[model samples]
Target: MSKIFEVPLYPYQRCADQDQATPVRHKVVVVGAGPVGLALAIDLAMQDVPVVVIDENDKVSWGSRAICFAKRPLEILDRLGCGDPMVDKGVVWNLGKVYFDERQVFGFNLLPEEGHKRPAFINLQQYYMEQYLVDRVRQLQAEGKPIELRGGNKVVEVTQDDERAELTISTPDGPYRVQADFAIACDGAASPIRTMMGLDFVGRVFEDNFLIADVVMEAKFPTERWFWFDPPFNRGQSALLHKQPDNVWRIDFQLGWDIDRAEELKPENIDRRLKAMLGDDISYELEWSSIYTFQCRRMDKFHQGRVIFAGDAAHQVSPFGARGANSGLQDTDNLAWKLKLVIDGKAPVTLLDSYDAERVHGADENILNSSRSTDFITPKSEISRIFRDAVLDLSERYEATRPMVNSGRLSVPCTYDGSPLNGDDCALMPARTRPGSPMVDAPVPGGWLLDRTGFGFQLMTIDENAPEALDVDGIEVKRLALTTPGDADGYLKQRYLGDANSAVYLVRPDQHVAARWDHYDEAAVKAALLKAIGR
Candidate 1:
């Protein structure tokens, strides 16, 4: 995994900017070509926005770093034109079993419903996800979309003004400069751009470290997440097991706060831990091993002047919920459309503030959940540990106590309950599909509902037909009309229409329900549309 992924996926090439006497200007310049940055660039390019992505290294991530991608992120990737390949090359799972001291406590089904297009989660190597994104970037470039991936082009320095941001890039030849109307930092947790900007990133830090080992072996474990709290193997501490592609399994062993960082990562020590968990009969080769410590934290403001942050750069959560990359993808989904509308002058510049408002709400939600999960997983005191174990015990025998258990509180899509962009809502409508919620996927007449709802502001009518289109103050909104006859599965009605026989919904470009009504009305739609775009 290391050697193959280390090979440059986007090797450096000299650009015209290097020869130019002055810095060349671009619409958007993205830093750090990780999954988040690449996804953002692909999104902007798909919208015909010129975006250049620069990274210090021209390679994918070395290890299977963020393997559990939830359904919401997969949906976001679908919109970016690369979801199919990711699912095709990944391991899918929905059911997860929790264990307490070798006893099966409880199990969960993340997506028990039938109509969703994506699975509850997919376990693909982070490198593979990044490769798919890079491939998408190349395909867009070949299609003549305004996107560029410049590997080995390091952003050495960045300075922003009210109008634009100027970045100095260090390339193989020398240093060159590029000016951008918007600069987005997608660098990892230790964001260099954040440091350079001198922004304060505040939150709780964890001293405890976990040993991650990706091993290859043929095993018969079910395609399910298995989490153990004080199993006989790794007795006092906790352990986790997940299956990835290529017969690879990810194992995590909680190493307490005080430990020798170097000695624990040694091959012999890692092998010993693996043997203790999985008996010696199962022969496995350690593919990759590393020690990681995570904390719950985020930037005070995702958008600071002309510069913005997304993904790990903007917020970081203890990986238990798989929120880091997943939330980052949502950040791009939320921001890209607003940027497009603002840049085209269709929406006021103030619309960008909603990005901060909405995503900050999202970040805070993730941080809160993540903090609770961390405390539950790694108890701070002996009394806390006793209470946790007792809860696990009760959960195994009684269904009522199962909800009290928190095995990393796996990631779920964020719903902006009080977003400023949110408009009208109907008390009769299903609360799940209310304003500021991601549209629940359902099977339609042609294909999936999400697939039918393309990337743009759309008016969705269920159990009733809407006009072919609506022009709300020069904003073009297409329509997707589905009927009761087409709702053969009843999911469309159950998920969206609720008790209402007919409904009309105004969907934002990101597929979030902006405003929904019992029936379509021009005046109401116009006001909601204008409010949604910060007019």
Candidate 2:
């Protein structure tokens, strides 16, 4: 394990709010200081929203949890002003190979196309990510931004009324009351806030379990994801291998439903398994080891009155597809803007309902995919196992059947297809970049396209006639005029404009397309803007 976890990033200290006459009031109070909480706080603070964050621990996590971060989350970190360090410290890879018993079935490339700013995926430890985010929070504080990080503060109770939410946090000195106009619970999967509020996740709990072991060693393994099905080392089971920043390698071994978890997690037992896979002569040290079960579940609604839930507090999924943290970041992305608008009084409170609508839609999609991946991985019945093996056998031979092998259908950005915030869509334009879809990245003149469209509503004009700016009521819509699509590496034309010659897009604060048209229309753009914010 790295010494980074030993150092406290946000050590607790006595704040003046604790000695106030009454409960100190705040604009927003976040319950957890995990990645989702910190990222959401940063996003809100970046938009000039005053935020207060509280967590029990002040350091990075112990184990290398959630090692694979997908491209969408990396882009989100980029917007949050912390992407460069994460990408620099991460191990980038795009290829993954699968095995059936002793035979190498086939290999697949995740990102075949180029011109996008970020890659398909990067293998980074969760601790490094949290460290960088904490550093960003400190930088924002240095810039005089309204953001506070308090460690050793545990939430003892939670209560909420119509106008605001209240929390009692226990500190080293004593407990004190804090009030917020709105509260966000990025607590965790086993959220104490969710429990105090009488909320629970509703979905499927898979029957199989996997043992996660992070081992440190010097080896010549290539930087890529490797999975094995019924391999010679761990027969009748599955295994996964991934590379991280340090010499640590994360390995997950499928240890069936019924087993002695305590016995399996023993260091000697874990070392035995590693020897089986990497040969007996190799020297390695077990850095971390734990057994985790699969769960595909979520709360029915992300928000209850004034308090909103984001990240693992709102949803949980199997880790096979790298969807857990990635989707949580997307939750923060879908939420911060909507919540900011409501607090600014520029939009109706009902705009927050769109956050619940769009993100719930996203959660359901991730749950569905995660459940399918789990089912494919650990079949319930013998006949199911036979069918799975046959598919793997056929996958090794036929190109069409290769896709049938489900080694975790990887994490991808979700499009809120029927979201209420979505507006007009043109059949003449491209489908990938249509309304309710995430704005695809492309090479622009200076750097990248996503660098310009974040934390604010903007209009992207591609060979289309649109004004430099427009004001719909009090909401200002800035324009990203790209008169020359040819200056871009033709990706803008292919991703945004397929059959249409000219295109205009209404992009939300989170960079999702609210609406698009073949050509710019003043009245249509205004109407779409109104609907996109739930007018």
Which candidate comes out best when scored by lDDT? 2
Q: Which ten residues in a row have the lowest lDDT in candidate 2?
A: 483-492
TM-score per candidate, chains pooled: 0.98, 0.99
* Candidate 1 residue-wise lDDT, 1-535, digit = tens: 5576767899999988899999998889999899899999999999999899999999998888899999999999999999999999999999999999989999999998888899999999999998899989989989999999898898889998888999999988999999998999999888999999998678998878899999999999999999999988887889999999999999999998999999998999998999999999999999888888868989999998789999999899988889998999999999998888877879987888999999999999999998998898999899999999999999989999999898898889999999998999988888999999998898888789898775688988876666888887678999887887888979988988888879999999899999999987888888999999998
**Model 1 bad stretches (over 4 Å):** 1-3
- Cα lDDT tens digits, model 2, 1-535, are 5688899999999998899979999999998989999999999999999999999888988899888999999999999999999999999999999999988889999999988889899999899999999999999999999999999999989998888899999999999999998889999999999999999999998888899999898888999999999998899999999999888999999999989989998888888889999997779888888899999999999989899999999999999999999999999999899889989998998998888998999999999999888988999899999999999999888999897899898999999999999999989888899899998898888889999898888999988778889888988999998855355468888888888888899999999999999898999999999999889
Residue 20's lDDT within candidate 2 is 90
lDDT score for candidate 2 against the true structure = 0.91
- Steric collisions counted per model: 0, 0
Error of 2 at 411 (Å): 0.4
Candidate 2: stretches off by over 4 Å: none
lDDT for each candidate structure: 0.90, 0.91
The number of residue pairs in model 2 that clash at the backbone is 0
